[model samples]
Target: MFLTFFEPPADGWHVRRDDLLDRLSREWPDARLVPSAEMGKSEMRDVGWTYDSSEETVECWSAQSGDGISLDGDEGMVVQFVSWFRRLVPREIDVTFCDDMYSFSLMIPPGSSPGDVLRMYSETA
Candidate 1:
């Protein structure tokens, strides 16, 4: 899966980065930090995740607007990660999802539940 977080404050994002990484580590011990260079950037870090199910890849990159998180892992695990991520979004943001089959986009308005967003993505794609 490919996912992007649109227009998130770069500075504000750092505050949540560690905790999120920690949670991912606790959940998926094989999970590890992904280097930004490998992510096609040199500034972003602590923004990748991996699990046992997939081909052990965690791709990420930083843009002027926000961050990107991509996984070639299990869809269910990615959905859980996305659900936990909702709390870290401070405002509405554009999210895009893509797979081999289709790509979908949606605006995650403030106060919207991540589960709902996941559901929408699932239903659409």
Candidate 2:
């Protein structure tokens, strides 16, 4: 599995890419957290809605996993997990699952602090 974290902007409250990767490395040492190539660039088009004013942008991270082809959970279970994860942190973090990509976006409140949102997602075996 792969993971990464970002740092806060030099002049803004946004989290920077390097900081995030560093944090993730400490948090999940076993995981290969790489510097996202899409950082500072608009890679994935925004196709969703957010309610947080602090979240200024989103980042994309990719990895190769042959574990399975589908996420092992029902819709309700996924929603509950996401809701609980959001409450643990102050910033808004949304996760998206596509064909082969698991995307997460950090939504910052207008006056929120700088840091990547932390949340746990589980897949059943």
Candidate 3:
């Protein structure tokens, strides 16, 4: 599964991709950026999203994209990422959880709290 984060336009909560990736790499050595190339494969639909971000600027990360990470690590990784993000960004950000197969997708609104996100994630689980 993948948990993608999008910065709302002019929200002042813009997330710098390089900074985020750097931090994530340090904080979670196993974490890495999802290559734009890999995102095109049919298996990428496993995130369950009906939309394609190939033409847009979206930041996607995988909790199960090898390198010692696995799908089972999504929950903890997501929770940590959200918690860490909330600390740095006071404004709202949009988050999406989906499969590479496009079989399931859930969007967590910017208005949602961490608890709410967890609940939604549980539903998908």
lDDT to native, each model = 0.51, 0.29, 0.45
Residue 111 displacement (Å), model 1: 6.6
For candidate 1, write residues 40-80 as lDDT tens digits.
54444345434444543333322333355545555555555
Error of 3 at 45 (Å): 17
Ten contiguous residues minimizing lDDT sum, candidate 1 = 56-65
Off by over 4 Å in 3: 7-14, 21-74, 82-93, 111-114
TM-scores of the candidates in the order shown? 0.53, 0.27, 0.40
Clashes of 3: 13
lDDT of 3 by residue, 1-125 (tens): 44344445563445454555566667655444455465566432222111122332223343222111113234544544544544433354444545546566666555566577677767876
lDDT of 3: 0.45
RMSD of 2: 14.1
User: What lDDT score is found at residue 26 in candidate 3?
Assistant: 70
Clashing pairs in 1: none
**Predicted structure with the largest TM-score when compared to the true one:** 1
RMSD of each: 5.0, 14.1, 10.7
lDDT by residue for model 2 (1-125), tens: 11222233343343333443454456434433324342323343211112212323222242221111122234333333233223323343322222224354333222321222223222311
